[model samples]
Target chain A: MIADLLTTVLVLAGLAFFAAGTLGLLRFPDVYTRLHALTKADNLGLGLVVLGLMLQAEGPAMIFKLALIWVLVLAAGATAAHMVAQRTWTHGEFERRE
Target chain B: MNLLLVAAAGFLLLTILFGLIRVLRGPGSGDRMLTAQLFGTSGVGILLLLGFALDQPALVDVALVFALLAVVAAVAFVRQHGLPEPAGTPMHENPVEEQPHDPPHNPPEDTHDR
Candidate 1:
């Protein structure tokens, strides 16, 4: 019972971080800042939530799945953010901003 | 457990809203691209939450593929069409600083559009 409660608390806390990240992504200016916000919170937030849930989960199968999801989050986040930033580079959108 | 999953999914939905707003009202194609990235993140969250609810491991494989695909598509598009610049943006700040540093870009007229 205590463990479940603790995990619940942790999950909720992670969710809060996710919320803050989303807000930062929306409220911040420019692609870099947006990417900065999105990557920080989304990655950590999801990671924590999965960790917290892993406590409640049973068996190696569940644990493996959770871990795989985290790996995907990390890999995908960097690549996509990079692509967006790359687009900004190729388009010469920066010159005018200068 | 069910209630917690539901709550988590709801919060994930909120993240979706933030991304969608960018898609709809973003100043340019690049902005829209960023918003689209949000969808992929939210989708991952949703997948995990669902897997937890169902106690299913197979879904994780699907999520993995989806995540990879989204990033690949984003990168391919960015490399191909170029990022769309937001209108009314200042012409003095070098926006390309956020990008990978490489090569010289030939100067061109400011093609500002709405």
Candidate 2:
């Protein structure tokens, strides 16, 4: 019962973060700031979701797999964020359309 | 629990839908690419929720693949699109530029007479 409750709470929180991240992406002024919002919020959201799922995993192996997925995403998201930021820094901000 | 998971997944889907507006109205390609990243992360969340809610472990593997592929897509975007840097700007502000090397340490000039 406790496990299920925890899962519900964690998953809901994760979804909230996802919503915020998307909102930032759509509304933020520029690419660099949007990258800040998207990369950080989304990854943390995914991590929370993974943690919630881990509680309900079938076995040790399943738990490990979920953890692995989260770790891979964390690493990949960081690298991709850096690359995008560097590209934007060098190339300059894209002109905004009125 | 199952219903909750399913509902959460649906919510994530909604977020992804909202992200699409950014893609369509992108003032820059980078903005579009960021939406793709949003899709990838949200897609993983949905797959995982569905995997547990529906009792299909195989869906977890699919989520794993989704995570991997998102990075690949980002890499491809960076490689394929080479936006022109602003005019008259230095190519890069590398750290090497911060240090001034002694003239003696520089490569020796060729001294052979013609």
The candidate that achieves the highest lDDT relative to the unseen native structure: 2
How would you encode candidate 2's per-residue C-alpha lDDT over B38-109 as one tens digit per residue?
A: 788899999999999999999999999988777898888776576443333353354543466654542222
- Per-candidate Cα lDDT values, in order, are 0.71, 0.82
Clashing residue pairs, backbone N/CA/C < 3 A, model 1: A96-B91, A97-B92, A97-B93, A98-B91, A98-B92, A98-B93
Worst 10 residues of 1 chain A by lDDT: A89-98
CA-only RMSD, every prediction: 9.9, 9.4
Q: Model 1 reaches what TM-score against the true structure?
A: 0.75
The sequence of per-residue lDDT tens digits that candidate 1 reaches over residues A1-98 is 88678778877877877787778767777767777877865588788878877887778887777787778778877888887877776665652221
A1-98 in candidate 2: lDDT tens per residue? 99999998899888878988998897788888789889755578998999999999999999988988888788778877887777777677765643
Could you tell me the TM-score of candidate 2? 0.83
Name the fnat for model 2: 0.67
Candidate 1 docks at the CAPRI level of: acceptable
TM-score of chain A of each: 0.86, 0.92
Please tell me which predicted candidate would have the highest DockQ against the true structure. 2
Please, what is the TM-score per model? 0.75, 0.83
